[model samples]
Target: MSGFVLNERLEAESRLVCILGLCQLRLMNDSRWPWLLLVPRRAEAEEIYHLTPLDQTLLTFEAGETARALKRVTGCRKINVGALGNVVAQLHVHVIARNPGDAGWPGPVWGLGKAQPYDTNSADALIRAVVKEL
Candidate 1:
């Protein structure tokens, strides 16, 4: 893969965090969840199978690392990781830290309600925390 570009929807919805071994880590805009997206820098990779075997391993490693970092940073009781491409065809993994009684608790976060945008200071703090852990 080459000349990789982020999906328009992702670009609009996320803030760039940093680059991982096989992915570009991005922070989701929603304040309701401590969400991060791991988007592989592989052009046209709308699914995991599209990546090379070695790249696949790297993605998994990166996702696991991101998930752990999220958990540590947020101190959430649970961590949710998924790659559902129904709305956005681009292949990206979601690493979210969840706690009981959260807005979307005991259910999927998608479409449960509106996403509350983070305040400037909160967003910066979260981004910095995740980056430091990573």
Candidate 2:
């Protein structure tokens, strides 16, 4: 996986948080929700089926761990986990922490509204909090 590279769109939208066993954890820049992306470090792998059995298992474990960390940090009402590759084909899972009255509640967050980029201080604090759990 030395040649693994994150897609440009993902790179632009997320900040590299830390590297886990089989995936690189990224913090989404949007501040509207506690969102994280776990992208497998497999070059040219667009879907989960493209990965080996071991890699597939690792992805699931990492995603679950990430979701737990988010839950601990945010205490969100719900945690949404999915691997929708409709736009960015990379094998990445979204672990979003959702609240009852948050924007786009009772619906998907995708395309609900403009993304509110996190300010520097808040983003740093959140990174520290999430890293502590990781």
Candidate 3:
């Protein structure tokens, strides 16, 4: 399949880490939770159903693995996993660790506040930690 472009708005808003197999794994700019974004490398994929069955399976497995890694790293009580493209229109899944007293605690992380940008060193460290397991 021909590769489609990930929009600049999405890329600019997310803290992309390293590639995890078939997806370009990213950390959400929000520091509220240990949030992640998993985007397949396929182009023009505005919906998950647009992917081939093989790719769909790969994305699911990869998202789960990433979620587990995030849970382990954060020791979070809960993990919220979802794929919603209402705003950016990219086929990306969100894997977020939830805690009782987090910034968006007792509510969804979307539209509650601004994203906390990570420092280069911190972002690099997180990427290193996650990539080590992949």
Q: Please write out the lDDT profile of model 1 over residues 27-65, one tens digit for every residue.
A: 999999999999999988988998999999999999999
Model 3, TM vs. native: 0.90
The sequence of per-residue lDDT tens digits that candidate 2 reaches over residues 1-134 is: 88898999999999999999999999999999989999999998988999999999999889888988899999899999988889988888899999999998989897778999999899889889999987
Q: Model 1: clashing residue pairs?
A: none
Candidate 1, number of clashes: 0
Query: Which stretches of model 1 miss by more than 4 angstroms?
Result: none
Q: Model 3 RMSD to the real structure?
A: 1.5
Clashing pairs in 3: 3-43, 4-43, 4-44
Give lDDT: candidate 3, residue 130: 71
What ranges in model 2 sit over 4 Å off?
A: none
Q: Give the TM-score of candidate 1.
A: 0.96
**If both were scored by lDDT, which would come out higher, candidate 2 or candidate 3?**
2
Q: Give the range where candidate 1 is weakest over 10 consecutive residues by summed lDDT.
A: 104-113
